[model samples]
Target chain A: AQSVTQPDIHITVSEGASLELRCNYSYGATPYLFWYVQSPGQGLQLLLKYFSGDTLVQGIKGFEAEFKRSQSSFNLRKPSVHWSDAAEYFCAVAADNDMRFGAGTRLTVKP
Target chain B: EAGVAQSPRYKIIEKRQSVAFWCNPISGHATLYWYQQILGQGPKLLIQFQNNGVVDDSQLPKDRFSAERLKGVDSTLKIQPAKLEDSAVYLCASSLEPSPYNEQFFGPGTRLTVL
Candidate 1:
């Protein structure tokens, strides 16, 4: 079975600082990777996804992720974080016609 | 375009009771999915429907959970004799197709609390 791993459980970053959320997946073949953000009491919204070409994929809200096949990782990065970026981030892998999500990483932006 | 719609923003029920949630996907979407999201955890896929047929339901607890998407537009997920562990937010999402490449739009979700 395919699975996604988010090493960080919680992260606190100062406002306007750089942010990087690590994600790794275990799969045999080429994987479809995705990043989603969920605010409190709300459903998840897609941040970005990597399907094929272009090792780096840019998504909504100035977010971007780099798909590194060698390490089986797709880490989300943002140059400067904002207060509104504080939310739970989920890394997911899609395979076998199904998608599996990681435990999730909670991001907190401090001013 | 309108996103997915889920009914009963909140529900409270006793353990071993029955509960149901309704979801209306975006018009013309061919794929619909149901997910269970526990507090502090990511959403877990419970079932997936393509049109009016079941496509993937491997994680759904068939013994206590049932879901139907008749007419291929709206869906209903029912839980009989709900347990305390079933307390979580039930999310509904839809995509243009069943392929992994399609982006899924999610609803606000129905929060279920079992006492």
Candidate 2:
């Protein structure tokens, strides 16, 4: 079974600071990776995904993730963080008909 | 186009009570999924349906949880005699296909608080 790991449980950064959330996966072959954000009491929204080409993938809300095959990691990055960007971020990997997710990382932006 | 739609934004019930959640996926989507998201955790897949047929439901606790997608459209998940541990958000998502390249659109989710 494939699984995802998010090392950071909670990350706090000042407004306008850069942000990077780490995600690692355990799988035999190349797996589909996705980054999703969820606001309080809201559903998970797709931020970006990595399927194949282009190690660096861009997504909505000024988010981007880089896929490193050797490291088995897909890390989400943002040059600058906004207060509204604060939310719970999830990293997921798909295998067969099921998708496995990490524990999730909570992002907090301060003023 | 309308995104996935789920009913009853929130629900409160006591232990051993029954609860049902409804979901309407994006039109023409062939794959629908039900996920359980506990607080401080990521969404865990409960079941998956492809065009009204069960694809994978290995994680669903069949003893208490049941879900169905009829006519390849709307889906409904029900919990009989819910337990305190069942308190969480039920999320419904739909995708054009089962592949990763296709984005999965999610509904706002139905929050269940089992007391």
Q: Sort candidate 2 into its docking category.
A: high
Q: Local error of candidate 2 at A84, Å?
A: 1.2
DockQ for all models, in order? 0.82, 0.81
Q: What TM-score quantifies how close candidate 2 is to the native fold? A: 0.97
| CA lDDT for candidate 2 | 0.94
lDDT per model vs. reference = 0.95, 0.94
* Clash pairs (backbone) in predicted model 1: none
Can you write out model 1's per-residue Cα lDDT over A69-110, one digit (the tens) per residue? 999999999999999999999999998687999999999999
Q: Provide TM-scores for the models.
A: 0.98, 0.97
Q: Highest TM-score: which candidate?
A: 1
